[model samples]
Target: MKFDLDDQQRDFASSIDAALGAADLPAAVRAWADGDTGPGRKVWSTLADLGVTALNVAEEHDGIGASPVDLVVALERLGYWCVPGPVTESVAVSPILLSSDERSAALAAGELVATVSASAQPRAVNADFAGLILVSDGQEVREGSAGEAHDSVDPSRKLFDVTATGDGWAADVALASEFGALAVAAQLVGAGQALLDASVEYAKQRTQFGRVIGSYQAIKHKLADVHIALELARPLVYGAALSLADRTPDTARDVSAAKVAAADAGLLAARSALQTHGAIGFTQEHDLGLLLLRVQALRSAWGTPTAHRRRLLEAL
Candidate 1:
């Protein structure tokens, strides 16, 4: 069957791109890293206004009632900009995990920011900013609190140790974890694309040996390889989204496979990007460093490459 994204989906994704393009996200990211969440929160509000916060919430709860496919489409764009905080948790997993809870309404409206942490997640990302942290493990979910901050490779991600508090309620932890993994996979694809885009732009501008480096065979080859990998990974991510949306028997396998492919593609793009940009890519001042660090963090988020590969093998 054809796997191309329809015109409407492409247009929707472009709208997110346009919105974030105007958000000055790199500046927002720097502000977030320095403990100034004002700019970041403003961007979050912009996303909320775009109905991103309501993508996965059920219609009964005044949500857009979107499918995982639509969720991933928006998620990929969020990743491209390297938007901070628990985007996957807030936009994708939380709605499904906290559907019955009253807080879900506030979350859908962007009036509150919530996050999730489980045995799989281990640490709550952006916990310092989250108004609610839900801890779960497939059978039950409970509100939790942040105890201590843990530094992440990506400075924008503020991970924290979490402990459950208050009463517990039932939830489908398995599905939430699967959806979380799928969201991260989509993010990886976006991060990988960011790396590729940055590298290509730098190559076109940075001259070496009296000519643009992008004209060199080696540079061209590296960029071409990353492009190919990202192109291949995109379908798997979207396919898994479709599988989850349809509640198919192979949903687990599809999600796991997508995670593995995305992580690998993202990491490959990272390495290639660093090579293309040379020493400059490693420096903090360069914007490429932001996407590079994000790729490293996302490679291991939700699930590691090895873990997903193992999960895919088990399914096989």
Candidate 2:
């Protein structure tokens, strides 16, 4: 069977790339880390204007009602730009978890931000910035509140202890978790690509022993491996998206497989990127640090690589 994004999906991806490309993403990310959300909110508003925030929400909720494939496409680009916040929570999981709520309209309009703690996960990311907080214990969902902030490897990803505050309702927590994993997998692919691209560019310019580093066989092989891993992970992500859209019986297994592949590939890219950039990559001033830190944090978010690998093993 043919597997590829259609023309409209490609165009939508391009528009998001262009819109985010014009934004001062580094500055926005920095401001977000310092507890200022203005710049980041503006970037999210831009995405909302492009209908990104509405992709998964149903039409009855004033959302675009796009497919899971479309959501993967949009989120991959968002990851490439390293847009900070509870991205998977707000854009992907919340729509399905709150499918019947009117607040989805506000989310579609970029008027509201949300964070979720599901499957007994104790902390919710970016809870302070979220107007809506959701907690699920695998069978039921309830509104929640942020209690205290916690430090993260990526400062831009603020974590909070959540406390349930209101009434509860039944929800498909398993499906919600799957969506979150799928979203994170897509973002991992995008972030890996970004890291690989930066490493490749850096390799072309930086020289050692009177030759450009790109000319070195070791550097070339390192980058080539990262490219191959990312390329392989992309299809699995898309495949998982398709499976979820079709509601296949294998959707959970596929999503876990995708998550494992993406986390491994993204971490490889991060390591290779830091190696390519040498010591400079570790410094706060370098932009590579941003992607590096993000990849680390995301590798464990929603689910850890080890956890997904175990899930895949269990499926087999």
Candidate 3:
């Protein structure tokens, strides 16, 4: 079996990259943080028009029924651009939890955004912006409403308490958690790559001691290490995606391993990027701050690295 993405998948990734590259992503992220969803929603609309929202839903729900690998491809680009909202929920988890065809169809059509909370992860992300809210307790899922909003390190990510009210239906919360972890792993890989790229570009132009910092051995080694970590983590992310798509026996184990690798790589990249840019990287006005904060937030979003590492060890 091939261990790489085919030409078609590469083309799809490129299309998403180009589309998001054109949008004012930094501005959109800022707007979302300030409780102004108009700009971010416009960016979401652009992604919907590209068929991103339909990638994971079933064909019966007017979706493309694309593979999990395809969903990862789209999400990676979203993370690279730092797109705001409940991305993993709307694209990865909701399709599995939602029993109503009408709700699924609305999701496929991008007419609805959804957020979910589970027994393990009780807070729903961006609940105020979601059209649908779900609360799950391992075996059952129920419709829910958003409660109080809580601030996140990444302002673009708003967590909310949710209260389950309606009758519930049977669903596999374990499978949904696996999918969520897989999606977050893919995004972490993308965000790491973005960080590496920014650091390299800054090193090339910023001069120190009358010489470009990129020429220094120390900077070179640091950036090289970041590159190596991201490269190592990326394949694991895709491999886990493939395992999930094929329903392999070791799917959960693979997903946990991938999550650990991605989280480590993403954190390393964030630290290196901040160090490379010095004090400017910490300022809110700097664009790098957006990616830095996002990487920190996502590192623990689905499950913490320590938790995933323990899960991997147990699965072994």
Candidate 4:
């Protein structure tokens, strides 16, 4: 089945892209890594003004009541920019998990930052900065506290070990897990795209043997392969989003497949981009490190590659 984004969706994505492009995200990511959230908050404010913070919220709850597709679109842009925050939790997972909770409105307005992790998958992203941390065990939700900061492979990500303090509510943890996986998959696709774009741009400028590296068959083939892989993975992500929107019986399987494909593709892009950039890519001074580390951390964010592969096989 064709799952192309409609014109409106494309336009909305373009708008987000434009806004993010102007936000100086690389500097913000640097500041986030240094424990200074001021610049990052400014960027978040930019997204909030764009209605991104409210995408998944219901209209009755003072949200735009956006679809899963819209949420994915916003997240893809977030990933492309490597925006540092609890985006997957706040933008994708929270509204679904806390639909009736009073905090939804504050979340939708970007006033409240929250983080969520499942008991089955217990790692909270940006927990130190989030106003709330929640853990679900497939049946019940619980308020949680960040125990200790765990440094993520991605310098921009501030992960935490969380433990439930008490019960919070009853919610569909299964659906939340699927949605979280799908959203991370979308982010992976966007990060992969960024890596590809950066590699292509670098190839045109870097010279080897007095010729543009992009002219070499090796660089050409590597970038082309990564581009193709990411292109293929993107559809899986969009398809999973549609499955969630329709409440399909295959949502879990599709979301797992999407996550696996997108993670693999994002990793491939990171490796290819690094190889193409050579010594420069390995340095902390270069922005390529940010995307590479992010792709590494996200590869196992919602669920590990092994877990997703196993789930896909079982579904088959």
What TM-score goes with each of the models? 0.98, 0.98, 0.98, 0.97
After TM-score superposition, what is the CA distance of residue 282 in candidate 3 from its true location, in Å? 1.7
Question: Comparing 1 and 2 by lDDT, which wins?
Answer: 2
Candidate 4 Cα RMSD (Å): 1.1
Candidate 2 backbone collisions, by pair:
none
**Best-first order by lDDT:** 2, 3, 1, 4
lDDT of 1 by residue, 244-276 (tens): 999899999999999999998999999999999
Candidate 3, residues 1-316, lDDT tens digits: the string is 6587889989999999898999989999999999999998998898889999989888999998999889899888888989999999888999888855468998988999999998646899999999999898878999999889999999999999999997998877788888899989889898999999999999999999999999999999999999999989988998998899899999989999999999999999999999999999988789999999999989998888988899899989
The C-alpha local distance difference test score for the whole of candidate 4 amounts to 0.88
* C-alpha lDDT values of all predictions: 0.90, 0.91, 0.90, 0.88
Runs of candidate 4 with Cα error greater than 4 angstroms are none
For every model shown, the clashing-pair count is 1, 0, 0, 0
**Over 4 Å off in model 2, which ranges?**
none
- Candidate 3, position 273, lDDT: 98
CA shift of 265, model 2, Å: 0.3
